[model samples]
Target chain A: MWAFDTIFVMEGMKMGEFKFISTLASVKASEVILDALFVIAIGVIVVFIALILLTAIFWLFGKFMQQGQKTSVFEEKGVNNDTSSEPHILPEIPVAEAGISEEVVAVISAAVAAMSADGKRYTVRRVRRVVNRPVWAAAGIAESTRPF
Target chain B: MNSLLQAIVDIWNESGFVRLFTLGTGNNLWERIASGGIGNLIMLGIACILLYLAIKKQFEPLLLLPIAFGMLLVNLPLGEVMKSQFNTLVPLTEQEYANYLKGIFDQSYPVFEMNGQYYWQHFETGGLLWYLYQGVKFGIYPPLIFLGIGAMTDFGPLIANPKSFLLGAAAQLGIFATFFGAAALGLTGISDLTFSSQEAASIAIIGGADGPTAIWLTSKLAPHLLGPIAVAAYSYMALVPIIQPPIMRALTTKKERSVVMQQLRPVSKTEKIMFPIFVTLIVVLLLPSAAPLVGMLMLGNLFRESGVVERISKTAQNELMNIITIFIGVTVGATANAATFLQPKTILIIILGLIAFSVGTAGGVLFGKLMYFFTGGKVNPLIGSAGVSAVPMAARVSQKVGQQENPANFLLMHAMGPNVAGVIGSAVAAGVLLTLFQ
Candidate 1:
């Protein structure tokens, strides 16, 4: 609301008192040129970010048509061996299910293993780390969890 | 009666104004015309028309009503009606006033010793409008208005569909087109009333249907032309309903306007929270010149978004906006005092203003149709026309027109996407112009 008072105070003193302060006032042109460069840079960034947003939008629309494919994939899984029968195995889900790359999955898996290195069969910290996993993947994992 | 006449003669011996008007102020009609007695009456007639447009037509009544009245007030000879007194708290002196107008000169004034110490004083003019005009002049009011605008605006829709940014950019086409129009008029050698690339560009921005940006930019680059530019900008903004629908109807077929857009998804609270911060950070970092306006707007949005600073957010929306609007209006009105405003270029500015607004609407709507073609009838082309930032007015026009084509179409929510986007578009166009000019 009140940004002008600084200009007033700076004006009240001559050079010596405001020696350090006057640099900003002196570099007005530089400030303006810097402003333009900054805007261009930001525009480039916003454009890329907007593309990311649009991808998310398109991804949302894709979810509707993929429902049938999702059910069939689960059906196919029922005929195959249950990966979870091997207690040490963590089943691999498609990238679409988790919205992450395989590399991101490995990094997450390593982090969880380190977090549970005390050798507890299952750890609460490990569970919380996996909670934000996509709903489809979470459902797939939940289908056969044995109640304690 | 004879004694009363004699008393009047005695009182008028000091000043002949009353007696002169009583005896008919001038012999010839032309002489009275030269005296501005007729000019004031003409100005009154103009003010009356403006009042009608504001009240009966409801074209930006909040500003137009006061501005029209202010016009009538200031036009009267030394009107006691609008004394334009300073706030009771601020004190100023003539020496202070003179010293301030000497600003550029003051920079080089002198380093002088007073009792073995040196001091320098900055120049600042305390002229009534010049002082307040400082805010208008250096691009201050736009952002302050933007702050109010930000608080009042709910970015939920834009956040819901972030891709609406395309519509906003599309609407800015009018700014570029008006530049050519202004240049063409300038080339015709019209009445020493030529627009510089800067001035013409600034004046043409009134078509964007954004008032504060138009005023802020015009005051900076073309301070002389601000009166007409501001009035035209606000007037057309108010006229969004009246002006835009014809082009919309003429351009679209019944099938086109009636195209029903799907219902907008409900945006999450978290999405709304991230939007202002994200958009502001991106826009301001890119366009720091736009930062003043974009920054303040984001600040106000942050207040609303964080869901914590409700009071400040409310104040920014209501009290702050109202106060600055009043100041923006009155000072703008004061600048229209006869000497500055009574000119041929003023009329030219008004004519160009209409052109700018019409062209802007055309551009936005036409682009919407193009998008509709690409989207295979999913997008209602009528909403495209409402991309002028007259806010709900333009949005409502889209809805009404679409309803005429198909009563059940219900494009209001969709039209709002572009309506709000137009605000950003005009602001960005204004930024581009400011960047060029500065």
Candidate 2:
């Protein structure tokens, strides 16, 4: 901006009549224009420095974007199964025509009721449970009958 | 009096309906209707190309057909039908020009005091495109139209592969590149041209290959260029399959195109459900200007992924997307009125836009090739070019070109990774441009 206004000043134009710059700011003389240019340069340099820093941050984030996510399928599966201790049931409603017996239902319900020690009838609900226990322990535990 | 009535009758007499049934035998309706002025002749030629692409080529027919038809109508010069100025009436000489021929001035539109004659001191008026331009100018309809866009987008793929955000950033190379080029080109003493640096940057961002992002950016930077930039962006997006394949083929050797990539891992619904919320919060808080686009887009994705919002999501994807697509397309097409669109600069705009797309494609693919070299052949080189947000279109072009090279290679799934990434990359670019330029 100062360089431009100086060229005009060299040509004998009045200080206030600097018409070439964007209609954003008025210039009083070459020195004022220099001051404005200095401020603008500092502002721009600060912005560029900020952007370069942001880029480095984003790059660091990108480095971790896919880290630690590359374990083999088989090994992960073995560890996952070993850490859970419940026979997961599908969320679908039990079909009566599929030979689900009333005795079995009653026994399971009473076992759960006895364990809970509550007054309400026991019912199966869909819940994602991840319990840590030995596989045999999960398989052997009977849902005992309980009541409040 | 009969002559006056005859004139009205004469207007319809030449109507093909009259001659068709009565005179029959010889060719009638189709022949006369085909007679076109020079403006229409050009429009028809362009329309024919679009028709061929839509019907025979099966390229984006839904949008191309209507847009082509609208262009045909606008250029036909059928008197004052698609009127440029709404107040353009043959100014009624109210009380007989008996007051000594007042004064005359070329004072364009609605001026109550023109030359000193107050014709409008007794009358009222409006600008034609002004009413229409409002929907384009005030950033109203496009964002509202975005509600539909937000409803339609599937964020699952993007969320499943968040690293693709890099590809999105890569795709915006054309926007910044074109902006610098346009700044150099500058108006440079073109009087009627009134482009702010931001305005020029807005128009240049259309190169990013994403329409909504282009619109979002344009609305912020240069509202005047909205109509042209939008029409161009969507038109080119529709043309992606045709426009990109040849370039892809030209750039890569047959063996390079055939490089196979490993299949993507199974994406879980749990991951998908969490994706939109995380992306929205991070991107919006970080770059508020990008919220209108990234926010709405993520919202749409959340609706689709949350599973519980299935009903609302379904309506957004289907009804909202479809309705807004039509409104946005037509309103944009209508903006190509003759006066604004007919200038020499428009051709330059088209030329520069194509360059922008090509550069963006090349930049992404080149970056991909670099990664491929570094990874020692794990990454397929063809997927990089699909890093354009034209969505499935750019990806499909990459797939087609890859198939041509090896005939056995299936690069579609791999290409999708970059294709979705390109969308995010362009948004990030938009955010950067907004932060700096605003």
* Highest lDDT scorer: 1
lDDT (0 to 1) per candidate: 0.66, 0.59
Report the lDDT tens digits of candidate 2 across residue range B1-438.
999999989987865334323311224443333332433454446656766776777666665555555555454453232354434334335442333245353434333535645443222333343345455555555555445555655544444444445455555566666665554343243422424456656766777888777777776776656556766777788878767777666666665777876655556566566556666666666667667666677777777777777667777777776666565555555555443554455665676678778877876676667667787777667777788778778888878888887776777777776786676566656766676555
Candidate 2 clashing pairs?
Answer: A110-A145, A111-A144, A111-A145, A113-A146, A114-A145, A114-A146, B86-B128, B168-B425, B169-B425
The clash count of every prediction, one per candidate, is 4, 9
The docking category that best describes candidate 1 is incorrect
After superposition, the stretches of candidate 2 with alpha carbons farther than 4 Å from their true spots are: A1-148, B4-58, B72-135, B140-157, B187-196, B253-255, B435-438
lDDT of 1 at B369: 85
Model 1 lDDT tens row, B187-250: 3445346566567767778877888878877877778777778888888887777888998888
State the TM-score, rounded to 2 decimals, of chain A in model 2.
Answer: 0.30
What is the lDDT for A104 in model 1? Answer: 68
A110: Cα error in model 2, Å? 45
True contacts kept of each: 0.01, 0.00
Candidate No. with top TM-score: 1
